[model samples]
Target: MKVKELEEHPTFAAVLPPATSEEYDTTGWRAFKPVVDKEKCTGCLICWVYCPEPAIIRTPDRKIEFDYKHCKGCGICEVECPVKAIKMVKEV
Candidate 1:
């Protein structure tokens, strides 16, 4: 069960679909959700830049929005926000 052995196995590779597909929804995997405080936000777009899923969105009005449908809630936005506007709250 070594990492290298599993990667080289045809059975393992064939069974697991590629995770790079645009339609692969990862919202179910989220343990926490990011919440943004609009008052505290300065429209810096830092969260949008640091997001791996690129789920943080910028509106036409220069406001920020979240795409919870595909957001994995990895907390990169919360960590990267210089204004501390985004917070990762418990999913419950």
Candidate 2:
């Protein structure tokens, strides 16, 4: 496969040979989870853009959603959110 083409779908693990656990259900080890305050969200997508893992999703209604399955609880989303809509709360 061409390098450019491969880069286009870099996270499509099924088609890629070297897939890691980063793209799987790694939530059990997390100590915290980022909760988005929808009322405060401005939909700027800063959190979505800065996420190292594909855990932050932009919904069709222009809302941000979290997929904890692959989230490592890095808090990058919470930090990047300009409106401070996301808060990292301890997981129970």
Candidate 3:
């Protein structure tokens, strides 16, 4: 049978349940939050730009902030920071 014909079969529907919250739940998702020491922050935007998820935001004054909602804690920002201002801490 053609791929499209197979996809329409009732048997396929029986085997495949509707998508549910359990299928996409991220209860186990772990992320690292980066803490910036204001004393060490040089106002460089490197961390903001290097974050793969754009989790870091830089203010007009060059102070950096992190949006943990989308941050995966990849540590790229910590590695990219010129000074040791950014430190990765496990999210609670």
Model 1 clash tally? Answer: 0
Candidate 1 at 40: error in angstroms?
Answer: 0.8
lDDT of each: 0.86, 0.87, 0.75
The runs of at least 3 residues in candidate 1 whose Cα sits more than 4 Å from the true structure, single-residue gaps closed, are 1-22
Candidate 3 local Cα displacement, residue 34, angstroms: 0.8
Question: Which 10 consecutive positions of candidate 3 have the poorest summed lDDT?
Answer: 19-28
| lDDT (tens digit, per residue) of candidate 2 on 1-92 | 89999778758446655766655678986899999999999889988889988788899889899988888899999888888999999999
Worst 10 residues of 1 by lDDT: 11-20
lDDT of 3 by residue, 13-88 (tens): 3456664533453323546678889889999898877777666788787798877656677788888899989998
Note the residue pairs that clash in candidate 3.
none
- The candidate, 2 or 3, that scores higher on lDDT is 2
Measured by lDDT, the strongest candidate is 2
Best of the two (1, 3) by TM-score: 1
- Which 10 consecutive positions of candidate 2 have the poorest summed lDDT? 12-21
Segments of candidate 3 deviating more than 4 angstroms: 1-28
Which candidate wins on TM-score?
A: 2
